[model samples]
Target: MALAQRRPPGLKAVVNVAGGLISAIAWRRAWMRSSRPSRHWPWKDTLPQLWVYAGNDDLFPPSLVDGMRAAALDRGGDVRLIALPDVSPRGHAILQNGRARFVWLREMDTSLRA
Candidate 1:
């Protein structure tokens, strides 16, 4: 919501990095609402979002993220996914290291600029 408010009136973009199942559920709900015209959509705009995940994340697997991305896109919500190559216990850790942290920053910057 903070991000949406920061954007221009008709522009909405989000960057989700190394999120867990809870995050996935929220997105699924959003997509479900987007598909149902009879439902009340609280937002005046649909947000385009980017999801970044570790390839071997156990908490939120790449496959799950991919599925969410597909569903969001199908609902006409802009979404993208980037899976980093690594099999580590850092499944839900976006700031595991300097480089990983940098990726989050870069994605956020890119999203805000768009």
Candidate 2:
């Protein structure tokens, strides 16, 4: 599956909006400094999972994904990285094209039969 890439303009606007929202909600009591919250791991350590990341994602920089891969490797977990060359985050739209959709379906069919 192709990674969902956010356009540059869309990415910038989303970041700005998120920052503004965070600032506006900063005064809420739920985020007060006195709150002691328990931390929990959502996934079991034994589960086999694949982490798919894009190298040219505008929302998430390549360095962040590289760091995640390094951390996962350190923990002895299997990490599969899929990097597309000369592609922007907006390239995800290609998946929506009829030809691309047909190719994706064919790949899925082959995988399932195997």
Candidate 3:
């Protein structure tokens, strides 16, 4: 509600507020429904064991990844964050373009084998 007031008047703002409200309501409903089940989400009881592979130029800020890492640590979960320097969100594509697809394939193969 506060967010809706801050936006300038336009179709985009109206759409955004409407979308946000709808999404919020839907998410609340889903969360309530899911919680009623006997089964628990693993992450709730035990911290998620997260393997975060993020690029510097991801659409989301790096702080988001850092926040996840912090939250995992707070919950006593193992968090492995691999940072690829000089990499963008499209870094893999760049690697492929540079004919480093074989390297990527090898890494994937090793990971799968492990």
Candidate number with greatest lDDT: 1
Candidate 1: clashing pairs of residues: none
lDDT of 1 by residue, 1-114 (tens): 345435666554676677543445555456456755323222343576777888777767676666665655555666667677663447566566567767667877777777
Best candidate according to TM-score: 1
Winner by TM-score between candidate 3 and candidate 2: 2
The better candidate by lDDT, 1 or 2, is: 1
TM-scores, all models, native as reference: 0.63, 0.38, 0.36
Candidate 3, number of clashes: 0
Candidate 1 vs candidate 3, lDDT winner: 1
Candidate 2 lDDT (Cα, whole model)? Answer: 0.33
lDDT of 3 by residue, 2-113 (tens): 3433443541211110111223333344434673321221232131222323254343234444544454355444444444443433533334333334444454455445
Give all candidate RMSDs, comma-separated: 5.5, 13.0, 15.3
Model 3 ranges with Cα > 4 A deviation? 1-42, 45-50, 88-114
**Runs with alpha carbons beyond 4 Å of true place in candidate 1:** 1-11, 20-45, 87-89
**Cα deviation of 37 in candidate 3 (Å)?**
26
Which residue pairs clash in candidate 3? none
The best-first sequence of candidates by TM-score reads 1, 2, 3
